[model samples]
Target: MMGFGLSIEPQLWALLFAMVRIGAAFVAAPVFSAVSVPLPVRIALSGAIGVLVVNTAHIVAPPEIFSINTFLAVAAEALIGLALGFVLQIAFSAPMIASEVIGMGMGLGFANAVDPNSGHATPALGQFLSLLLTLLFLAVDGHLVLVDLVVRSYEVMPPGAWIAPQRLLNIAMFGGYAFLAGLLLALPVGFLLLCLNVVVGMLSRAAPALNLFAIGIPASLAMGIVAILLALPAMGDYMLVIIREALAAAPALVLG
Candidate 1:
């Protein structure tokens, strides 16, 4: 008796397509895209998730992987993945924006450091806020929620489906909210800094012999640190809301 060979054509196609989508999402998303994450580990994670997605969804394989139609479908999958990840990235950037505003106000804008997450030069204050947001993101299990959204997207928007124009519009509209959230996060400290600057300016004008530059910098730094400590709890709450909204928006981005 001869043993039958298992057909791997459909499974292979499903895995390839799934991997493309998952890989694209990870490339654009935060946390997973951090410079600290090794490339090989990222690839392995993507492949593993792709395998699970393909097996669970039983996604239909394209008639021919090398055909123009199949190529377009792959491109569509990639676009969907990118769109989903970009939404979260925008949301996560709120803290960075707020930090820049507060840092400039506090005279810490010049204190530059290399950000481990992005591997770029950023103000020390900005880096601190970014780390705070990152911790909040993980603490709330935002990453797992994002993965669940991506997996569910396969059911709502199967392969080969094109994203609607309205959905793109919604995403663009949704991004504006991130700026608003950032502004809210920075406002308390920014206002305090502004008032401090005004007082410093008045004192400088009133006393010619006093060294404003030396005095202002140190005072701003001390007050800013105090303000940050006072505002940390509020900032964490704001970040959680932003994260939840971003994850909520992910479905609309991919499924619509």
Candidate 2:
């Protein structure tokens, strides 16, 4: 019995390395990484997937479970997993950025509420947009894609593969795209509000006696809400692209 168990030690270590990457991905991925998920649950999920990876991928057995090389491979796996997770993390930032832009424009920035996902007091628009993005994320089955990508990583990079410099460059480059998408998501509402503000400024200039307070505030509020409603369909389309790009980028980030 002792010899039989010893013979499988290398296989078990390989599974351990695989779990490190998956667990790191879960810790870093957007929806899965939410503070709301208990650590024990995340670890368990990683373990389950790790078991699948070892069975399906036919990963090479580790040299020694307690050796320095095994530790290094585990660290590399974690790094790769984090890179995969960071791709989605970047994608999820778009809605938050848009929310901030629209919220500040609508004078809703001061209206703060606790975010259930993050437990932070974000502006009202941020909360609304977060909810919308969350819905869109689930609607597109992005969560499944995230899981699939991590699983695919085991096949592509496997354990003990060298991390390439270009992959790190790609991760950095992806951040630029994330910021651009965030701006694009926010642009419609932000621009419309800017136009509204200009009109309000003109009104204030033309008639100093006009109760700009009474007139402009309600006007901006109504316009902001209308703009958001008008932008909804486009926002959904934007999210579709964002999720696709994020999922596609995951394998590159993890494997490279």
> Model-by-model lDDT, in order?
0.85, 0.83
lDDT of 1 by residue, 1-256 (tens): 1222236666776788888778888888989989999999888988888888987885876888689999899999898988999888888888878988998988877889999889899878778878888888899998898788788888988888888988888888888877888899898888888889999999998997899889999999988989888878887888788878888878766576
Using all chains and alpha carbons, the TM-scores for the candidates as numbered come to 0.93, 0.91
Model 2 misses residue 11 by how many Å?
Answer: 3.8
Where is model 2 poorest over a 10-residue stretch in terms of lDDT?
Answer: 247-256
- Model 2: per-residue lDDT, tens digit, 123-233? 778777777777888898988888888898777887777579888887888888767888999898889999999999998899999998798778888999999899889
Clashing pairs in 1: none
In Å, residue 204's CA in model 1 sits off its true spot by 2.5
RMSD (Å) per prediction: 2.0, 1.9
Question: Candidate 1, after superposition: displacement of residue 180 in Å?
Answer: 1.4
